[model samples]
Target: MKTANEKKNKMTTSEKTSKYLMPNFGVRDFVVSGGKGSWLFDDKGEKYLDFGAGIAVTCLGHAHPRWAKAVAKQAAEIAHCSNLYMTRQQADLAEKLVEKLGPGKMFFCNSGTEANEALIKAARLYGKKVTGAEGKKFRIVSAIDGFHGRTLGALAATAQEKIQKGFAPILQGFSYAKYNDLKSFEEQMGDDVAAILIEPVQGESGVTPADPKFLKGLKALCKKHGALLLFDEVQCGIGRGGAFLTSQKMGVKPDGVSLAKGLGGGFPIGAVWLAKPVQDIFTPGTHGTTFGGNPLACAAALETLNVIEKEKLCENASKMGERLGRGLEKIAKKYPGKIRLTRGVGLMRAVLFTEQYPNAAVCKKLRENKLILIPAGCNALRFLPPLNVKASEVDKALNIFEKTIERL
Candidate 1:
């Protein structure tokens, strides 16, 4: 008794989703339509507890009222504009970022990868200018298992070969070193090294936190070698690791910080903060973007920052992250050989299955149960809930998680 439109709407979304999308990325069979607070709703009206939060993009929770209002107002005013002209939204956002981040300049872009790419370019330019390496000595030292981006420059900097296999003949100037190993880093810190880019916590590598001593040692090494120390905070910054900037928590300042993911509260935007010394790496005509700081995205980013500060979401994140980690530890203790480790900070955490490597099947089953979690690193699961998620919500998620773990 259904009409054509009604029938079309009633049809299973996975049928169409699998048929239409590119085959490169794997997707679960969830057709999400709307979101609010810390929950997402599917097209079929099924409710989902969102712990992923779009890979840490919705930091203030999905569709925060103030953020939504800001986006709506900006959309009504103007959505797209080029960097050729002066934009108040972009200017104001940059000023706020520099003020909070301290003594640094900013360049707006569209995603984490773009932000990283810009950082890479800036480092190479610095190498060429200061190190007297015109073209030959432009190599950069990066941590193994680091995830920069998919673009040529960023991917070249990324240390994972599985992601870089077919994208062979990647852009040059990237050397890999052991993460949290000062001796390994020291061995690689040579004259040709342009910069040493690293993530404070390796999110894609199962939320592994870098050692503080190692980071400080690397900072000193970079200074000794005249190489810029760049922090790829795309996944760990904007309060992802419980702090505005992860380096601040470690008490070691990097020359540059690349950020995105959580910056725009689900809106598309990336920002790179450079210290005062390297501020002029990209002159006016050297680099630009068409829609990087479009009014809509800036509005969303501004609200996200304000909400995180005013709502004390960072503090909430720290408290809840500890709670989640403790609960996960109990789970790990119950299942001795099956669970290997738990690493994370704030709201970012991961648990690895010891039995198998990169157990996508476990995640597949979790998705089937509608619990919604993804595997990290070689054999782990990541939990990246919104920063403002309530303790009660964590309890609910833990219940579902316990059930799922028991089945596993």
Candidate 2:
């Protein structure tokens, strides 16, 4: 039997969600009320080490003082206005991103999906420019297992059959190629190809990092075919991959990059950076967003950048990522039959479980042990702790993870 208070709380939360919200996402029963640093607290005051980091969205962790203060201050001053005018926040944020990304222009939007859509549109315009016609060279080649976004344009670029199943007649002119295979991509690189878009570190299918040589080969291929090389760094950018952008660490210079997951820490803000050659594709009337780079969103993103640089969070991500990788490797050794291998760079790491131990089962058991993880593909578990996570926190998470595996 449940108390009246528990019944009332249920009515206000899960029950209400069941009645009102759409049945799209798999809703967790745990009601998260607050978080700090690298931990989350449910409404019942239960603390859990948050290794998922909101699927790599919260790069600075739950609530950083600088980020919160900047958001609050900008919200009080001016939350939003039409893109008809400019704000200091937008100007500063754009300038910072351009500097960090190396000679590019930034377009702001509301989420990663929107950022990819903008990139897709950019590819189309570039294609038109290359072939001197609207649809002459407008095909896009993405990886087979790549997960771009749910929006139609981004979805079309995503080659997953399961994701594209119900949505019939996906946008046309999109093709698939084997990821990290130079020859496979070359087979698809016809004159009709406009862009070769890929995630330098594929996050959803699994945290699979691209081979550096393969990325360089794609850039050469794009140059030869007059097609743009775009990188979808939404999940692996912004210090999460031990660098400002994972592609940068990989030493590949792409024509465009899509970013969003951690761009504003926890706030919703998406951005696309286009290199100088194709920056002029989107003229004044081509594209725009009303709430994309508003004062509050820009402020939050700017403060996130400020904190990452000042605290050397990128270096921290690299250092702690090594520690976490080593720990996972040890665990893999202990359970060699059950665990396959660990993949990914920096904070964007995943452990591949053998069929004997499924990902969903391990994830559920971890949650019960007060540790949060994200499931990827069929048998991979993602561990995306905050970039600024303390060493002690990493050790604690590793302890919990090993113990959980032991019990299993």
Local accuracy of candidate 2 as per-residue lDDT tens digits, 1-408: 999778767686788887778989777577899999999999889999999999998999999998999999988899999799989999999999999998879999999999999999999988888778898989999999999999999999999998999999999999899999999999999989999999999999989999999999999999899899999999999999999999999999999999998999999999999999888899888898888998889999999999999999999999999999999999999988888998889988999999999999899999999999999995899999999999999999999999999889
The estimated TM-scores of all candidates read 0.94, 0.97
Top model by TM-score, which number? 2
- lDDT of candidates 1 onward, in order: 0.85, 0.93
User: How many clashes in each structure?
Assistant: 1, 0
lDDT of 1 by residue, 146-167 (tens): 8998999899988998768898
Error of 2 at 30 (Å): 1.5
Clashing pairs in 2: none
Q: What stretches of model 2 exceed 4 Å from their correct place?
A: 1-12
Please list the Cα RMSD from the true structure of every candidate, rounded to 1 decimal place.
2.4, 2.4
